[model samples]
Structures are given as C-alpha cells and as structure tokens.
Target: MHDATVIGNRLRTLRKWRGLTLVELAGMAGMSKTHLSDIERGLKALDRRSYVASLSTALRVSEADLVGGPHLTQDPVQAGPHSTVPQMRIALQTNTLTEPATDRAREVGILTAEVKQLEDVFARCDYVTLGSRLPGIIDELHFHAARPQNEAAQRDSLTALVEACMYATFRMKDLGYGDLAHQAATRAEEAARLLGDPVALGKAAYCRIQTMPREAGWDRKLTAARRAADTLQPHVRSAEGTAVLGMLILTSALAAAVAYRLDDARDGLAEARDLANYIDDDPCRNWSAFSITNVGAWGVALAVESGESGGAVLEKARIVDESLLLGRPSRRATFLADVGRGLAREQKTAKGALGWMLRAEGVAPQRIRNSPQVREAVAVMIQRSKVAASGRELRGLAARMGIPH
Candidate 1:
C-alpha cells in the first residue's frame, strides 16, 4: 500500500476533507486542474515551496500539515538528532533577558570559545552534537549576559548569546520545531538589539526570515530581507559586513523565486554576485557562506524554482566550485540536493538524479532525510523508476526517509 503520509496522499485527503474538487483547489492555488490531479496521483512532484505555500493558504492549513513534518522514525541515526528539542524548548521558554534560568555560568571568554566550537559543529551538519550541546550553552550564555559583572563583560556576553541563539534557531528549524525555532530567533534578535550592533542585527534578521511562517508571508519575508540588505549595504567596506549583506540579498533572491517573481529574483541574484566579487569564500564569516561559488549555488535553486528545463538547471549548477562548498556540509548538501531536485523534474534525467541525492545524503544524512523538497523528489523519482537497479536504489533512499516504497 502507498504511504498515507506522503505529500500526495496528504494533499488528496485534505482536499476531500475540505469538500473541494481538484478544479476548486487548483483554482484557489492558482494552478490548473490537470496539474493538481497529477500531484494528487503522485505523477508530479510537490517539491516547490511556492506550491506548498499556495495550497496551504487555500486550504487554511499550515504547510507542515501538507508536508507531514516533525516526522518521527525508529531509526536511531535519523531520530537521534531530534531528541534534544524538548530540552531546548524548555530552556528557551524558561529563560529571560533580565533573569536567566541558570544561576551560574562560565567566564565570557570560555563561553565565547564554546560558541565558536558549536558554530563549527553546525557547519559540519553534526546536528546530534549541536542539539545536545545547545540547551546548556543557551542557559549559560543567558546567565552571563543577564548577570554581567562589567559593561565590557555584558557586551561580550550579549554577543555570544546572539550567536548561540542563532545556532539554536538553525538547529530547531532543521529538526522541524518551527515554533521553538521562532523563539530562538526572537532571542537572537533581542540580544542583537541590546548589543546595538548593525551586523549582529542583520544576522538576527536573516535568522528571523528563515524561521518565518512558510504557509504565507512571502511578501513580508522578501521585504524584510531587502530592507535588511539595504541597511547593511553601507557597512560592506569590511569583509564581515559584505558577507552579511550578500547573505541578505541571497535570502531576498530565494524569497522572490519561491514567490514566482522571476524578474525580482534575477535582480537579487545579480546584485549578490556583484557583492560576492569583493570577498573570498569564508563559511565562518557571519556564517553567510557568501561568495561567487555560493551565488552560483543559489542560481541553481532559482533556476529550478523558475521551472527551467533540467538541462538548463544542470548548466547553472556546473559552474559552482564544488570544492569551495566542502567546508560547510549544510551548504554543500543543500546544493547537491537541489541539483537532484531540479533533475528529477524530467523523466530523461530522473535516473541520474538519484546519484546526486545519494551524494547529498552522504554529506548530511539528517538534512536529506528531513527535507520536504528532497523527500518529494525521491517520491516522484520512485514512481517513475522502471529499472530494477534504480528502483532498489531509490527505495533504499525512501526507506531512510521513512517513506514506504
């Protein structure tokens, strides 16, 4: 039997439950009846964020309902990373800016070093370690920031808290704890505002945009990214400022592309490329990963979202310096998974898409397993696979993602 949790199954069930026909849902979502039908039948991949956002809006449900998020699995490797979410949530909820939940904390310098180490862990996509360590770090940082011994110590503690909270935001989001992720983002923004640092505030803005409700708010997300980018443009004389500004522009480009604004997306990409030319690829710099190669990686995603042909998308992916992506497993895996997603759109290239996805999984198993886009692409490819070898390969991937094949 086909899995009831697959996006197609969920979509069909939701539509019927709402007493809507395919034509009605499609009309509401700004798509054709035939397209909606294909999606319901699993012939078409429901991989586009824009499509999910539209359908969720039309159905008056959250995007997570359609995507079946907070996906629990028995496999330890896949399920282990999510184990710490409850603890992290408690820490975030119980703590405050003026009064932290913890009473004692290490020195500011030690906490700062630990935060840096956790940032490295994040870059490697080591979510298990990242999640396990975050709650303690968060509480400690909060204690230090809230109970500062001196003005300099207070500034240092607040700065470390912002970075720690940002890391927590990323971890929560990746593990599908959207509400917790938003709380983490809010904490980060609060710390940045207290510090009165423009770059820190820009980083916090990026975190907020990432955690914004995916069901709607495309315009709000895009506007926020553009406004943050504009505010940071004057600070680009330093590498850190340039990288953060580039990151914001890339965020704008992605928000535009997902909103189906091709012209705006291209303009954003063009502007990002110009900024990227001024800096080197430094994954640690503001954690932006903004560089010429990263811009190319973003281009592949934009092309895929724009409904460009598979060959065209592959052409865009070809120019990105894959070597530059190695240090940041999250960025590297995302780039590879997006390439697979784009190629899986066409039957002619679907067979080859599996290889790229496998590479992505090898780079970051948790990320690939949790990604709705990657999961839907795998489902579509499984439905299309005829050869026994490819079928076996695709089924293995599906099983890893807890999707029955």
Candidate 2:
C-alpha cells in the first residue's frame, strides 16, 4: 500500500497545481473544506473504499498507483515529457501512464490530443472555429476523466466536461450512452467538491442530478437537483463561477420544470435570470454564449413547461431563432424542444406540436446517434402530442416514438 502521507500530499499537490483553492477542491470532492484541509495537512487519512475510489475517478489515478509511486504531477496536456517517462517509472513504482493503448483506447487517445489542443485554445485564446468543436470537446472530456495524470488535472477538466455533459444531456436527452454520460457527470460532481468554488460545486451538482430523472433514479434526481439549486448563491463573486451559475440555472431549472415541479422550476428560473443579467454586464468572455444563449433558452424552456403564457414562449422562440442559426445539432434539438413545449402550452392543435416535435425527432438522429436529453424532451412532447387532432401519418410517427395522450 502507498504511504498515507504520500497519497495525501500528492492529492494536495495536484489540487494546488490545478489552481484550485482548498475550499474549491474540497467542495468539488464533496468533502468539507476543513476536512480536506486536514487530509492534505496529514492530520487525517483517506477512507480508501469510498473516498479513494471517488478520489481516483476525480484524480484519474489507479487504486495501485494512488498507493505507491512517484505520482505524476505533470500537466495533463498530451505532450507530457518523453524524457520524464523514465522518472515517471522510477517514482510511480507502477507506471500507469506509459501503458499502451488498445484499438478503442487509441481512438480516445487521438480524441484527447485534439481535445487538449482545442481546450488550450479555449482557455488561453479565442477563435471563430471554437463553436464547431464543442461537441467533440465534451466527448473527449468523458474519455480524459478516465485517464487524468492526477486528481488535480481531473479537477481542472471537470468544469468544461460538466458543461458539455449537461448541455448534451438536457437538450439531447438520449445521449445514446446514458450510463457513460451519467458516470461522467457524477465524476465531474466528485471533482467539483475539490474545486471548493461553491458556484462550481453548484453547477457540477446540477449536472450530477439531471441524469437521475431518466435513468431509473427519479427520486435521487429530484432530490439532488433540488439540493443543487439550493447551493447556488445570488452573488457574482467570481466572474467565471458566476457565469457558470447561468449554466447551472438553465440546466437545473430545466430538470425541475420537466420533473413537474412548477414552483421549484419557476423559482430557479427567476434566480437564473438574475444571474444572467449579472453575467451579461461583466466583461465579455468565452462563456458569453453560455450566459446569454443557454440562459435564455433554458428560461424559455422553463416558462413553456411551467407557465401558460403563450406570449412568453413566442417571445423566447423569436429570440432563440434569431441568435441560434448555426445548426449546431444540440442547440437545434434544444430550440426545437422548447418550440414544441410552447405550442403544447397554447393548446394549439397538436399540429403545431407535431410540426416542431418532428423536426426535433429528425434532428436528434441526424445530429447524434444517442442523445438522452432530446429523447426525454421529445418523449414528453410525444406524450402530449394529439397528432394535432389530425394528420394520420404524423400520428403514426408520433406513436412510434411513444407520445402520450
């Protein structure tokens, strides 16, 4: 077994290297900041089964590697030093990083190279092509979390990964791989506890709970989503964290709205709107689309689901239609779902609902092979679609996908 002091110190070092404050990292890890402080300081020992496994997922270290080794503190950038491979071997006792890749693993390896290259540009720079890569970027995060150089790198990657997971999960619904997406989101939440940033924690927690409703854990989904909502504060303390709050608002509120909790959904949207305003006024940054586009889309979605206001839905539709024209499959799926929800709210003939819902159904298969978010949202509407009280062929289409009523 690895020495407890060494493990703790390695964890602490990784956390620090990622630039996460103790409170942030602890919060991301789901441990109290004080307790994390004790562990890092050597006053307490890690509980291997529960704490260590989660820590491993969050840290990307193996059970064996976590116990003994020189431990990789190297940056997770794919270009890890070739020369250090030997030193990495000497210290690690068991060299996990140098392991060769399998066929599937090799694909993921290339994906990681591309993702890191893009993410570096995402973090330190800007480019017109960035939006084009968002989908692949999220996919890579799922793959990378399983192979981080250390807990800190995992923590560092958690925020972006969660953003991708939540975005895909909500709008897509059927991400085809529900289990993988759920695990990815769960790991992101585990890492959020280490981030110690309450705002980040709130965001990660939101994604963690969202997979619950559709994955046979509705009870946990409802409970955890509510809990995560409770954790987001109404302050713009950290510009980035606050911007992320907008994402939390949009995703968590959408979950609440879908769960049929009108009160929670409404309250969550109100807070989210306020956060959006704050995020808008701050200096422009990469998350501008996050705060503006997604925030607006989510608010409209919550309103359509929980409110009877046709004007509100129409208004939101107008805005989303104007700003969202990239044909990004996830965004298209999200917008189409909201439009269907709006028509459903108006009691417009099922035709209106059918029109948009069909477009969404078509969009889902075309954009992604497995999207749970779109499936769930579409399924809900399919439940509501009365075939617009007409269209025989359309009803057939709707029936096949499981529309209710």
Candidate 3:
C-alpha cells in the first residue's frame, strides 16, 4: 500500500503556500483559530462536509485537493478503476453532441441493452467493470443520438444517451474528477432537454445538483433541489415522476441538514416520505432507486448529517428494511457506512462502528476504500482503540486503507 495522506497535512501545506497565518486562514474559512490549529495539528478530524467546503473555498482549491483523492494504489483490484479514468476523460473531452469521436457503434437496441447492463453494474458498486465499460458505451450512445435512422430511433437514442451521461457523471464524481462530472452532467441535461420528458429532465436535474461545485453554498443546493421538485410536481401522477420528485426532496433534506436547518430538513424528509408512500415499487430503479426502503436509508443519513447521536441514528436505521436494500448494493453500502460514521462520533460506540464499516466494505470494497469518510472513521477508531483485539482489527482496516497504523 502507498503511504497514507491526511487532510490536516494537506491543509497545513496549502495554508503555508498561501502565506496565511492560522488566524488569517481561520477567519477566511469562518472557523476559530483554535479549531483551525487543532485541524492542522491532526488533533481533530476534518470530516464534516461544511467544514471541507469552507476550507476549500478559503484556500481556493478543490475539496479533493484538501481531502487527497483519486487515491491511486498498487493493488490490482483497487487500481483497476483508476486506470480507466484517463480513457474516460478522453472520451468525454473528444465527443460532442453533434459529432462522436468514434465512427463504429453497435445498433441502437444493442447499445441500449449495454447501457442497462452498465446501470446494474453501477447499482452493485462494481466500479471496475463499470469504468471499463462506460467509455465505449458513452461514445456509442452519443453516435446513435447524433444521427438516428428515424424519429423513434432518435428518441430512443437520446433517452439512452441521457442515462449513459448520468452514469458517467456519477462515476467521474466518485473518482474525484469533478470537472469531468460537471461536463457529463451538462451533456445529460442537454440530452434530456432534447428528449423533453419531464422524468428524464428531472433525472438530469438531479445529476446537475449532485455535481455542483464543492464550494457552492448549501443554501444554493437546497434551493436548486426544491425548485426542481416543484417543476416536476405537475407530472408526478406517474410512478417514475413521483420517485424522481422524491429524490429531489431527499437531496434538499440533505443540503438543509448540512446547513444546520433542522426544521427545513425535517420538512423535506416529511415531503419525501409522503411521496414514497405513493410508490409501491422501485420506479426509479435506473435513476435514483427511490422507494420506501431508499427513503428510510436517506432518513438515517439525514439523522447523521444533522449531528444526531449514535443511538438516535441507530433508532432511525431500525425502520429501514436491509433486505430491500440487497437489490442496490451501493445504497446498502452507503447506509451501513453512514451508520458507521454516526457511531464513530461517540467514543463509547466507536468500537462497534468498525463492524458496520466492515459490513459496508463487504458490500462494496471499492466504494468503501475510496471514501474519505470511511478513511476518517478508521483513523478516529484507531485513536480511540484501547483493547488489543479491537486495536489489531482497526490496524488491519487502516492498512487496507493505506493509512499508517
């Protein structure tokens, strides 16, 4: 494993590069000087999204710059996903809506099927397979979308292109290519606008919201989500529309939670719950996976983001049907990881937190290993571990994360 890098070390380096004192940087970031000192000295974990956003904005760098990402590694299993990113970047950069970089493409029907298969791989959090397959599919879909044989073929190709770009947006963002993610999201939005389906447009809006700049204010994200949901309101008579709207509401809830607006966050969650009650099936499967089960998972995440205690988050988790989450491995892994993060906040429950994180890793090793939150949680547990057996387990996990133990 490569030597681990911590946010504190990066923060200190960036601060010095900018020639700013602790007091100056803290004032710029809207944090106390003492707090900034603690974060720089590695006495505190830079885990909160808001803090990361503020500091990145203050430092004039990306969130990934502070967090140290696109974590390249020697382990083949882990390195496979990162290797494909260069080709993915080239594909996105070279292709345009009017002209595809590649001339060869499969039939529209075959391309659609391939896109659907990739979607399933994405749900399973199989990043290696997804990354390897995405560039070709994206190029092919763009080709078909640009010059279709007929009107029906054009619509089908455009829809498939929208979905493919959505997947690309998510993959790029997860891999720490924020600019590529934004570019993909823009392509999705363009395709959706051409398709002119409200649900497709809603999905595109969600992708755009997800890829918003890390320094973007939480209020801006909340407003964008709410506005998108409202625009989709008249079309929610269908299950797909309802599910998409529900996802937008949940996004709003998360933004509000991060902004520390408890009442607004609860309102958004309540609205999403009502929408979830209307859909009996996973109508947004290829998109948001919006369902009652998904809603419950979002509730647990909301509780954690709102700074709830471990017991409170666990209480929320009890209502979620983990069995239902089996169909969506990424969601399952994220829910379990959120539970782990919540538990890790308290010293008394920190040891138990490792169990949930390990379960999440079992579900999605690539996702868990790449996650900044998971890395921070492991570091925290290592600091708090007192028992020899638990310490050994924590060290093993840290080693897997390439963190010094």
Candidate 4:
C-alpha cells in the first residue's frame, strides 16, 4: 500500500518551495486545512488512482513525475524533505503485553486487530525490523499507565495497555523470546489485577499458563479460566451476555480438558450449549458472529480433548461444518484438531495424524497461530506424533521453545 505520509511530505515540500502556507495552499488547491494536512501525512491508505489525483492536485507536481518517484509505496523512500516518516519497527510483542481488557468482548477485538496488523507487517515490514522493538512496547505500556486521565478514560487506556502487552507476549513467543514473554505476562497480571474486573483477572490468570509446567499448570489455568468465564453470569439475562459467559465457560472447559478433568469439561460444555441455544433462538441478542460460534468451536475442541465418544465426533463435525468460520484461521485450527483427534481414534495415520497437525500449523501462522488457542493443539499433535522419539528436531523445538514440555 502507498503511504499517504510520503505523498503528504512530497506535497508539503512542493508547497513550501512555492512559499505557500497551509492557508495559501488550501486556497490554491480549493481544499480545507484538514484536507490539506491529511494529504500531507501518511495516515491515509490511498491506492493508485486516488494517489495520482490527490498528489497531482495538492503537491502541484505532474502525475508522471509523482509516479516516477522511488517513494511510491511503503517500501522505503530515500531520506529527503519529501520522504516518509520512518515507522517504528518493534520486536515480536510478547503475549503478556497484549492483555485482554477487563471486559470480555474487547479482548477479542484487540487480539483480532493485532492479528490483522501482523498480516500487514508480514507483507510489508522486514521481519528483522519488526523483531527489534519488544522492550520499547513493554516500556510504553507502563508509561501510558502512569499518565493522568479521568477514571473511565484511564480504564480504557489500561485496556489498551493490556492488549499491547498480550501482543508483545505472543510476538515474543513466535520469535522465540521466552524471557521477554514471561516478563510481559507477569506484568500484565499485575496490571489486570489493578483493574479488578473478572474478565481482566481471568486473562491475567491464563497469561501465566504458558509459564508453568504442563501437568501442574493447566489446573490453575482452568481455575482462572472458570472464574473469568463465569464472571459474566450475573449479567447473562441478555442473549449477548449469555453468549459472552458461554465463551468464558468455553475457555475454562478447554483448560479442564487439557488437565484431563473430563467431568468439569462436560459440565462447562453442557452449560455453554444451553447458552448457545438461547443466543440462537433470541432475536434481540446483540451477539456478534464470532460470539455465536465461540462456544460451539470450544465444544469441538473439548470433544477432541476428552477423547471423543461414539457420537460426539460426528456431532462436532456437523456443528463445526455449520460454524461461522468460513475462512477463519482459528476455526480451521480447531477443525484440524478435531480431525486429528478423530484420526487418532481410528488409527488413521501411522505418521500420527499428520494432516490435521500440519493443517493446524498451516492455518495458524497467518492467522492466530501465535495465540493461546493454537498451543494446546500443537502440544497434543507433537505428543501424539511421537516427534519426541529421540529426534534432533524434537529436542531442538522443545528445548529452544520456552513452552513447558
């Protein structure tokens, strides 16, 4: 995508050369001050067509000359008066840095936003460049927290800080920066506790899951997930609230299944199922599309974790097939795990469910691969695949990865 800032800088430079103030330029171009300033900054994501017309009109440069310049895209433009401001390239943000808000739905929004931004970075920014700013992000989160604001605004900023922390933590993990991620998650919990909201506390609890040993950890994670999931129950009269509660319960169920707490997982899933039914039946429900499918998706994961029973596999398949995950990466990961679990049941793959495991990995790298949701599947896949059979790659992946074995 073409950076508006560079084009804006070009326009600013040309106007200055003509000795035009923004006021003078606005008159010349028959545009407003805001419009002129907007054109000068790269905040706008203009395409080729808009680029030509706007730059030609505002910069007073010939379209041919504008197009001919080397600074046409997000690709680096040479340093000069008409160049782009260098955007910050930060290192992988650890998961802890990207904390969920003290509210349920906002966490989804923040994570979703980060996932989208990551896609852009992968497409345009150099991996090495984006990999250098982890420490700065952590610093910024605390700095932002210390600034003064009204109570409501302060809460909102805290939410943003938590989201940033979570992103940093995940980025740190994906880039193999465990110590940074661990530190960020630790800090995130402290911040979330300050907020004292169930949703935030839950996220704070789950954030530490990655730091603990597998057997001893999931239990605490499940406890935290359950508390968070159940936190919205008091407000569940509304269909949307019910759906949100379902999601929290669903999270707890996942942890329970991982910890081999089949009874607990079953209870949560059953409750989630009832909530999903109400959300579907109610017309006034304010649930988003993701909110609706979140529970069913969890059910599928839980089914797999619980070693899918006689009809549970088919039910999950049918349910997931009807899910909102038309092309969703997280959904695909869930589906892949379900498939892998099914395969495991039938002695389907001698290579140990390679298809599902590989697809989960494939679907995630561009989507939510670095997310907390994807790890359980990966752990199950690796363990089942027997990749740890004294292989060089297995030891390397386990030892190098900060994930508890």
Candidate 5:
C-alpha cells in the first residue's frame, strides 16, 4: 500500500477524534478546505514540514502521530557515542608524560601541524574521520602535557590539549550530544585557564554557552555571552581575540532570537557586524568565519527561526553568494536547512523544501540525519509521497535512515 494513504488515514482519524470537521481543521491549519479534504480522502498528502507542524498544532496532536509512527522518539544520546566520555576521561587521566628534551622543539612543530590538520578535517565536515582521530590526539596531548621538560614545552602541550578538546567539543555539539559536548568544553576551559590565555578562554566560553540548559533561560545565556565578549573586546588587537569576541556576540544574537527577544537579537547582530568590519577573514581560524557576509547569512536564519516570512527574508538570503557559505561545511548545511524552512514557510511544496534539505544532506549526512528539523522535513516528504511514483527517491532515502516504510 502507498504510505501516503496510511498517513492520510491517520490524519483523518485524528481529526474525527477531536470532533473537528475537514473545514474546521483546514481553517485552523490555515489551508484551503478543498486541499484538506483531498488529504483526508488520500488523494493528497502533507508535503511540507511547516504544513505538518501547523496541522499538528491545530489538531492538538504530535507531528509524529500525523506521520504514523514514532520515528523521532529515539534517544540520540543512547544511540550515539555519548558513552565514550568515560573512556576519554580515562585516557586523559592515564596518559604517560613526554620523555627527555632533545627533540622538544621539533615535536612541538609536529603537534602544531597536526592541530591544523584536525581543523581542516573539521571544516570539511568529515565527522567520521574526526571521531576516529580525536582519541589518539587527545591522549597524545595529555601525555605531553603531563611530562613537558620545560615551561615552553609545557605551554605547547597545554595549548595543543586545549585545541584538541575544543575540536572535540565542537564535534560533540554538532552531533547533538550536549552532555558530552559540555564535558569537552569543561576540559578545554581548564586547560585554557592553566595556560592563562584569554583568547583561549573566550573560545572555551563560546562552546560552554551552547551546552547551557534551556531551562536557564535566554537572559542568563545572553548575559554569559555578553560578559565573555566584553572581556575579549579590549584584547582586540589580536586576530584570535577579535574573532572570538565577534562569534560570542553572534551567539548572543542567536540566543536572543530563540528566546523571542527580537530587540536584543538586533542589538547583538549589530555589534557583531561592527566587530566583523575590523577583522580580516583568516582561513586558518576556521571558527572565525564571522565575516560580514556570514553575519548576513545568520541574519536570514535568525529571521526564519523567528517565524517571520515574506519575500524579504529569502531575498536577503539570496544576496549571500553560495560560494561564501560553502567554505564552511557546517555553516553551509545549516544555512541551506534554514533556507528550506523559509521556503516551506512561504508555502512552497514539500518537494521544494526537500530539495534544499537534501542538498545539505549530500554535503553532510551526519549533520542532516542528526537534525530534528531535517527528520521532520523527511517525515513530511514521505507523507507526501502517497502516489508511490513521486516519492520513490524519498522513500529510498527514508529506508536508508531506518524510517519505517
């Protein structure tokens, strides 16, 4: 049987349970009565994530129910590498110190190059390769930090450890492992403190801000971000400091947007844009992609997330060259997902939204698969595929993702 028919049946059943007529549900969902009738008759399907979200909201049901299964209920932490934290902690605690002093300078140079390599891999969005490499790098740095022969060597090892842990924190956060990400950030903060590097502390703080609980509220998160950025602003002569401060401000804007504080979001974005003006784009500082163009891209995402929709939001996004976004795979993927969502909010079909989301998935499968938004987008796509022929590709993709047919 066509899966769309099954989805349509479920939706119809839900509406009946609520004692709502087709016209009533359609009115609440802000769709045409005829279109809603077609869906109830299994002649059409829910084709957009926004549509599914809207209908579910109107019906007082979960989106998962409309889609006919609990595809989204899986615990990401249990299903992924969250359990690796204890092992990583053990590696840090048990590593042996570096030996002797003859090749300390050469070894430092090698470790620096390795850190660069790791950053490059991260920029490319090669999470699998990064995951495999992190343990060894963490152990090596810890080993060196434990047994450096002199002060200079100790600083080198400590710095390398901070870099590695920061990368670990970034990857863990991307994968949606909040607790593990927070642990990595904590380790990075400790190392940064021992090194007495203010710039490094700013970076660690940036990672910590993401792992903060939503229960803590946006005011608390924004305050923390403001304090970190303000502290780094005076040290703005250094490129690293400038980048960290700009990013912190940008992050504050994101937090404010999520909390519905549009005024605060605007203020933070303006400050970040001003800071971005004074800083040059440094490729080696991959995290510093907080350029003016990047700020515009983020502005588009923030607008979409705020439930504002019109030609203006998508138009603003269009002016940002796709090439600029491609330089950072994570940013590129997120920007594309936001664009897809904005398109959907504009009443585009599920296929249109899926096109944008699939483009992001093609570049970074882990990113898309791990995203709740993409999962719901895919759920809508699958529901729309009721006729069988039109949804074949999406069905194949869903099968690969272990979404039940």
Candidate 6:
C-alpha cells in the first residue's frame, strides 16, 4: 500500500497547486517544515497513517489523493461531508475578523447563547446540525478574542474559543478524522493558555487526550491523563472541578486499560468514582456530566477493554442503572457497545451480544459507526448469526450500518 516516491510527488504537486509554501502547509499539518520537505523530496517515507492523514488535511486533499487516488481538482472543502474542517473554513471566509469596541455587552450575550446552543446540539446527538452551526460560532469567538477588552471580557471570549475548539476536536475525533482533530486540539490548548483558567486548561488537556492519534502509544495517553487529573484535583470541592477531575480520571482508566496496566486502570476508576460522588448528577462541566453512574459506565468500558468477560463484565455493568445512563445518549450508546464487546469476546452469549450492539445503534448510530470495538463485535456476531434465527435481525442491523453481507 506504500509507494513512497509516488506519495512524495503527489504531496509536492498538491502543495504547489494549493499555493501553500512548505512552512504554511507544515503548520497546518502539525509537522515540521523540514519533515514536510523531506517527505515531498522523497528523502523520507510517508508511511505512517497519522502522517498521511495530517498531510491530506493540511493540503485540503483526501487520504485517497495522497495514496494514489485521482487528483482532486475541486475545492478540498467540497470533497468531504459536513465535517468540522470544511465548516471552519467556511466560517473564516464569511465572518468579520475585527470586533467593534462599543458592543461588548451585546457580543457577550450572543456568545453565551451560542455556547448553550452548541452544547445542547451536542447533547441531542444532532451532529449534522451542530456541524452546520459551528463555523459561525467559531468565527464569532475568534473575533471576540482578537480584540482587547477588560480582563473579564477577554477571559469570557477566550473561554468560548476554547469551548468551540474543544467541540471541534471532539466531533472530528468521533468522526475518525484524527489529523483534523489534532489541529482543533492545538487551538483549544492555545486558547486555554490565553484564558489562564485552570478549569479551561484542564478541559483543553482532556481534548488533547481525546484527539490523540492511536499510534501515539497508550502509555503516553495515560501520562497525559494523570497529569490532567493532578492539575485539576486541587479544585475538586466545586462541581465543575469535580466534573473535570472525573473526566480526567475516566480517561486515565481507559488509557491504563489500553496500556495493559489493569491495576492502574482500577485505581484510576476508583478515583473517578470518588469525584463522581461529589457531583449532584447535573451535567457539571459543559459536556462532561460527571456522576456515579457515569463512572460505572466507564467501568463497563474498562472491563471490556481489559479482556474481562462473561458474568464478570455483565454483573459490573448491571450495577449502573440503564436509566442513569439514558440522560447522555452518547455515553449510554458507548456503554452498550462495550457490553456487546464483553459478551462477544467471551463467546458465552452471542445472541445477547448482538442485541446489545443493536440497541447501541438504535440509541446512536454514529457512535456505533465510529467505534472500532463495536464494529469488531458486529463482525463476530455476523459469523454467529449464520446459524440462528436471532441472527437474522443482526444481519439486518449490519446491513443498515453498511457492513458487507
């Protein structure tokens, strides 16, 4: 699949056609200019999946273009679906970059409403609608942050920018656009630094962890998670503080599971449980709804990730009421996907596993489509469905999800 010389030549051709110098392209791609130049000159290989993805996103091309597909003569933004990159570009093109000095109150109120709208859109899993609106929201935040006002105004503007960038990171990662997500994470981190708010910084760190490429190594992810938890733990008495703490700890448990440190994973989850207990079931932080049940949901995912199976995983999942999970459809969907995984991996309850996977898709089709573990379960369940009547429904669900029959 790797043709290094061909890939390098395509990279050069695309860069020239787009009128981007190596430095500009490298900045957009989150790589060094020298490294980008080396790849274009065929002195280095473009063999890594992450690098190729970032290069394609930077050049406003597709992975297919970099990997020997036909050249894309149209605007790159026109190539993808309603993803964040295209939308952000549109936002930049349309919105005024300079903010007027006199309408500070009006602008702040507008931003507050927009932030709530964005958060509600995410909560409802209305991704397409959210994508459509994000460009304008992001553009407005940028304009607000670009101008200097009072400390309160600047902090509010920067926090809004951080939130918008974080949303972009989360949405892009959920859609499997790791490279694009990385750019958003960088913006979130930069904005968080500008705000100088500990909570925003911690949230930005969480976004960085969420957007991290899988090849970055699970151990590195675990380290980042621990650092975020440590940084945010000092403010654990407040609800938002506890929510951020819980988020970091939840991420740590998952990262530890992926790193194969089962004990560390459990310890992280235990801390998450404590933080969750501090919250009052409300969505404490913008998108992070930290609650005891949410911690239990993570426990379900961790158990599956750690290769726990059979009744062990099922019993653990049972401890958290399904109703508690229902408030956040995305989290509930993920939990059910893990249930499917645990069952399928153990090979003890094929029919039940298929049912759980189907239920997850019913709750959130995008979550299942984006989840590698859930897809694997579907693949295994497809094989099992070959013999049983219950398998017919699984087959139908797989077909609806575009799984090959």
Clashing pairs in 3: none
Clashing pairs in 1: none
Tens-digit per-residue lDDT, 1-405, candidate 6? 122224567789999999999999999987899978866764444544456656777777766666552111122222222344576555534443354222333375588678776876675555677677876677667667767466677778778878777777776666656766777787778788877778888889999998786546678899999988898778555677678777888898888886678899999999888766655765424247678877888898888767677678789988977886666777778788888777765445766777788888888765565453454456556654545777678777656544444
Q: What TM-scores do the predictions have?
A: 0.96, 0.49, 0.93, 0.50, 0.74, 0.75
Candidate 5's clash total is 0
Consecutive 10-residue window with the lowest summed lDDT within model 3: 279-288
Quick one: best TM-score, which candidate? 1
List, residue by residue over 1-405, the lDDT tens digit for candidate 1.
123377888899999999999999999999999989888888789988888889998998988888876776676667778877788888899998898998998888998899888877888778888888888988988887788889899898888888888888987888788999999999999999999989888889989999998865677789999999988777656887788888899999989988888899999999999988788765535455788888999999888877774788889999998988888888899999989998898888888899999999999998778777888888877777887878888999988888778
How well is each residue in 204-297 modelled by candidate 5, as lDDT tens digits?
A: 8998887775445566888899999888777766666777888899888877876678899999888887877777643335355777777877
Identify the leading candidate in terms of lDDT: 1
Off by over 4 Å in 3: 1-3, 15-38, 41-43, 58-61, 281-286
Deviation (Å) of 403 in candidate 5: 3.2
lDDT string for model 4 (189-286, tens) is 77777676655554544455554423244577678667656564664455545655665677677777766788998897887777677656321223
Evaluate model 6: give its TM-score.
0.75
Ranking by lDDT: 1, 3, 6, 5, 2, 4
How many clashing pairs per prediction, in order? Answer: 0, 39, 0, 28, 0, 0
Model 4 poorest 10 in a row by lDDT: 77-86
The residue ranges of model 6 lying beyond 4 angstroms of the native Cα positions read: 1-85, 89-106, 283-287
Report every candidate's CA lDDT.
0.85, 0.49, 0.83, 0.48, 0.68, 0.69
Identify the runs in model 4 with alpha carbons over 4 angstroms from their true place.
1-138, 149-153, 169-182, 209-212, 215-217, 230-232, 235-244, 277-292, 309-315, 349-362, 366-405
